[model samples]
Target: MIALLGCGVVLLSACGSMPVTGDIKAVDASQPGDSQVQVYAVAPRENATPDEVVDGFLESMTSDDPGFRTTRKYLTKEASRTWKPSAFTTVLSKAPNRSQRPVRDSDRSSTELTFTLTGDKVATVDAQNAYQPVAPTAFSRSLHLVRQNGSKEWRIDFVPDGLLLGQSDFKRLYRSVNKYYFATGPAADQSTLVADPVYVRNRTDPITGMDTVTQTVRSLVEGPTNWLRPVVDSRFPTGTVLRKGVTALAPDDRNVLKVPLNKKADGVGQRSCRMMASQVLYTVRDLTSARVEQVELQRSDGSSLCVLGSGQAEEFAPDGSSGAPDSQYFVDDEGHVQRIPGSNKGSGDPEPVAGPLGDGPVRMSTVGVARDEQLAAAVSQDSASLYVASVVSAGELPRPAVTSRAKKPEDRLSAPSWDGRGDLWVADRNPDDRRLLRLAGGTGEPSNVRVPDLGGARIEALRLSADGVRIALLLTEDGHTTLKIGRIERQGDPDTLQDVSVVELRKAAPQLADVTAMSWSGRSRLVVVGKEQGGVQQVRYVQVDGSAPASGVLPGANQVSSVAAADDEQLPLMADTEDDGIVKLSPGDNWQTVLKKGSSLVYPG
Candidate 1:
């Protein structure tokens, strides 16, 4: 087990002894940024033999090329023309090994050679950009090589359809890039663009960053990544192509990118044209060292159709496009929903909200705020029932949304979560009936959510993304817990209640043996509280792609009952530190007590 940082003692009074002071503080906010510059190795010597060819090919597969074009040189003419590296990509946890023998020694002029490859498959990415989880599996492959026609030099005849790379090489060779896709929301902001992240080669050429922008634009025009296709839509017309005969792309001196699309974009709507331009701007802005203030969409003749400036881009709330809220909402000492005004400014005083749930007779054990922040869903004190209430004075009294029929108090309901579309989601913990229910907004019928491959695991906690497309779940089976992410699949008509299903369930934090709680820190990052196998409990940040970064311990707190973060990345992370009350932590900051008297705290995303 790894030793935790910031060791200290924090004492807690009996649960009811904490007080609710009406005082709040102001907190300073900051943002974090990053960059990736890659250096690729030179290609193998031209006169290399079969064995040398195989070695060089495998090594070059990990290079930062827009395509596996560099690795194709090791193959024969016909084989190279038939090869498709992007059909699938296998990511290995450790480096792969190839057989020492690349040819049959007995027959010097043998036309065929084979190289055996082996590795532990960690994950696989299909052409559609879907990441499928695989167990720690041992797999082997055989590559066929042959001497081309009359040439003594051996070239690969047949190879796998995908690219293979070690974990270290993946980190060094590729960079995560965000392509914008529109989120479905209310009519007022229905087509709001949200970021869908995908990994692309860090650079086309190691020297200049020119190819990065071109590669990104090509991927965006290819349509939303496969995993995000169902939940989001793109504005680029189908079959849109760059200007004829243009092999590369770069912004002009004015830092304005003029993207020439094919005739497919001929008669597009003005709003959609602007949105497409925004998608391009957001995609290439960070990739270029030049200040990109705007992206212009044009016809083949170079006539400008629309232009989107950096100032006009509308990013998702979770992307920190919208500033953090002035305060965070939590339950007061009386179990009433209250706000800590100016939470980003270090304000800690409690202020009751102007709503029925604020000071009403109803008391909740946990609460979830809608993405709009006007309504809240809460669990009753006993946890047997779920309730929805207005957080504004213009609303009505709290009403029971769903109640469990379980006789055992322990088998009640978990906390509720609100998606970007305002639907409330919760799981019934009753062992007799493990059901994930969705309560539609404004009197819509509740429906069961189909969870794929749930097996014998019980749902301990679940949180939805602001885009309403994915869910983070903590499941327990056989005394062990696992954290998994699944894509939400909605079928049928929206007017009539439809069945909601979860497909492509993949492990998010495969290293964590026990996950007690989790919350989305961003569209692609989740802050999880759990313990690794044989490790002590701790809090850490994990990417949806299953990358865990270093994290500090919660000072003075031994155990955390729950964890939460605002959808706005600028806000700090708040958690109910078990016996230590409520504490908050900002990036590069230590955990500090924000409320010395509250439990089940949360900052709705």
Candidate 2:
């Protein structure tokens, strides 16, 4: 039996004279900590009233009862047989408010009671456990109850198929985990893995009776979410699934996890099997407390298919095996691109990058380093010209790869960004000829990438994800700036350049009234510098899906103009501030000044 916390029954009178007897307890819907305190539902008491039955069911939805069996006790037999909690989840800003009303029969007698649950909807978790945040809107759902034929007890006969939870309860019961998938497309490398983030129960999943690890692996085998499916692939063979009746999975004493798959994966080649094992190793690395040093794939007949160690899995790492970046780059007081060792110990004197962009005639105001750190794309001081050159060897400054004809400096080009595919992206802010352009291999002719849903908004800044499949854009319109994440779709052969466009744009930070800067901080997260309505500027980490994490907000800084973060979390976060020049915030430390006169700081994309 599970222990119940902060539960108490409240009794009241019905018509100012008759007594109402039932057990209706208020749920303590507070957010749980990292330890993940568990909550379980209570069975309904005898002779419960209609309101009591509805309240009991709603509270039970927030608990960890196995199969939600206790919750079904408050429902009619027909409803219990038909309800599907795994269909989806509706997340509200707070616990839903309930109001009761009576349903009349043809004879004008009260035959049933309907309780309406209403709140501010914040997000929705689809059947695949994919989270999608939406602008907050009003939500209302009705549950109808009736008296049983044999007993006077009230039971719910009509209820929604999915669970309704408050944001706080959702955070307490679920966690966001990234499942790995191989990148696909003309420019994508077959060996590189991309992150596909989804939500899963933090502890044991009630609906499936599976532990966290098993649930995550199940989600992985089910493939990527709808939004990301077009750009990624899974090595797991079609119709692959966990062995029948397997609910719990644990790493062995040697920290090796063995996964038993159905026959569909039994005939895969050695290379494909190893790649599949790597995907599992990467996906479960962060989900469990115990270290998973290796993963072994097993056939349906219990024979070994292949094994992959953690070190071997690094070959398919999204950011490559270069480890953390060596240095951070920025423009110095002299308008020349410079770099400093990207270490947390202490700051070092800035040095010029090896080529023309560092010492040439053209003064650069902003810079973007390629993922490999071998090349850099710099925008001229006036923001009209974008030049690309090698950062490892000295050479003459290459001609402008892209140039904007916008008359005003502020209306010219935004900062350039390089994706993991070695391609370059930048937005021209020219009002008469606004276009989002991409350079094939950072050298080919600039091509205008179509943005079908941009409407009339202007792009203030743009950052591409390391996987090259998602692009973050700070769109400004009517004096308001918002952050949006767009999906990058490419067409054509792998070797030759082709058409590229950004589509299916979604808001990444809807709560902020104005966004000044942002950078990709993790696989599916961003460090955003923005301000909410009637609020001061703040630094927070927001998931690509728009939902804020538990530890999202960072320590505050003043007058921040720009911010940068490396894919590796250990590297300190750097920012350019008007009051403090360049500053960095290391893990477990407050912001410290790195330099007193540097700007446009950034780590390799």
Candidate 3:
């Protein structure tokens, strides 16, 4: 048996108080945020793999499973550290690995390990859950511990399931650990080759008045290769799109064009330096390729192409067209990008597609999407599911950037939206016991008993109805956040989601503070929730077409938290009265109390 020490009292001079789970208490007990979070300490050893050290450190922090403890015969004293063992292994080195919840019903769900010491505090052993851990994610975990209290005692804590790699971390981690076949493209040694391609949506924006033909390619250098695919993206108009030739043989058999590089043109001097590969046998790369943010495709003849992969935006320009964004285009047969002259910076273009489907009501702010299904909030302050409207983008990451702000604590209109298939999505702070009850009128019904992500510590304002599925969640850390809207896929439960598409809000209106109260409005327009320099809550709209945000700031609504818009109808925010009463916003300057006094307002959906 390991000796229980009274060192905690000597080490921590502060008065006795319980530290929150997963919170890192200062070893020095200084003012908060002033000290570094000590994850682990190590005595330098020879020839140890980083993973080995990480594993050893994690092993020291967990409680051994009774089954494992029996298998090993007894506990080893060499693994001793400042803290006792945890309930599970932080690393993916053993059995009982972690698994995602069958479905994600809430806005945020995370899988983590907790380490408790003999004292009052606990440490988070979540380091091994890095986005791109070398090993596949694990579900099995064990805690190794010394006999505490002489009774083989173990305190039980809940690690919410359904945690997966964060989108940003997942992007990097997966890319780092997974070996990917380079999507090959035609190799260009030095000589330039040119080709032509057609029959696709032209790479241009009608809203910002940015046309493909009007652009030119100033130069061409091969960009990064994914799965062996050649790429190019030059922000200038000329560099915007590429002309990829298609050897499309069957129009009905397949929807996309794919063409093999003419290998017949070899030995042309320019041939050695310039190489080409098989494209979809066509000039147009589909929206799948456009999912990666900052990529644009063009075809030969500069006729048609795709801008954003999942039909999202690239840069959020005040005037629509992004300047100097990560751009991609196609090369011609001679390995030369033919469209020499392109966009003149943000000289202006048409509005980009704001989001999925068409104009709807302000209530559309509360929306969620699952491949074919959608659920939205009702303005009547009741929870209900609505049929989702289908929308498509030219980009690959199909999810949309919802809004920028989180709702104030427990704000209803700021609650979650529903994906079509099965999952219920809410803000980080969603009420744990929420349910999905379907609203009448739709042919189908919303999934009940759905699981949610609940990314934030508390649920705030949430709205999702039409335009596009939008989810706005607040994070407990520094109050920063992530807003999501777009397509989703389900795994098990009716409402559990497996994957989601990232709708580049850059494709939406390029305006900050356009979102008034909620983090996201709809996929089309996000309600600006942040107050500009002044404390006034201005209501702005993002068109989703890559132009400036709509100039619709409703003055006088200082405390506006959620705003919804119907087609051509006035957008309204959940206005509050001093008495807590809620009311629909009426025309006025900033700071007007739209609701009667003492009416603690709930989100009117």
lDDT winner, 1 or 2? 2
Per-residue C-alpha lDDT of model 3 across residues 1-605, encoded as one tens digit per residue? 01112222111211123333333333321111111112112221333322333333322222212222221222223332222322211222221222222214333222222332221111111212111122123244333332223443222222222212222211111111111111111221111111211111123211122222221110112221221122222121222222333312222223332222222222223222112211111122222333222232333433223322213322221111123111111112221111111132111221212223223322232333332222222221122212233323322222222222224433333334432212334433334433322322122333332324433333334443321222333222235332322222223422332223222122122223233344333223444444433345445543222222224454544354444332212333344333333344433523433323222222112
Clash counts for the predictions, in order: 15, 0, 195
Q: Is candidate 1 or 3 superior in lDDT?
A: 1
The better candidate by lDDT, 2 or 3, is 2
Error of 2 at 213 (Å): 0.3
Q: List lDDT for all candidates, in order.
A: 0.70, 0.86, 0.26
lDDT per residue (tens digit) for residues 459-561 in model 1: 8888987767788988899998788888877867666787788877778887778888889886677888888779888788777766544342443345888
Sorted by TM-score (best first), the order is 2, 1, 3
Model 1, global lDDT: 0.70
Better of 1 and 2 by TM-score: 2
Give the Cα RMSD of candidate 2.
Answer: 3.8
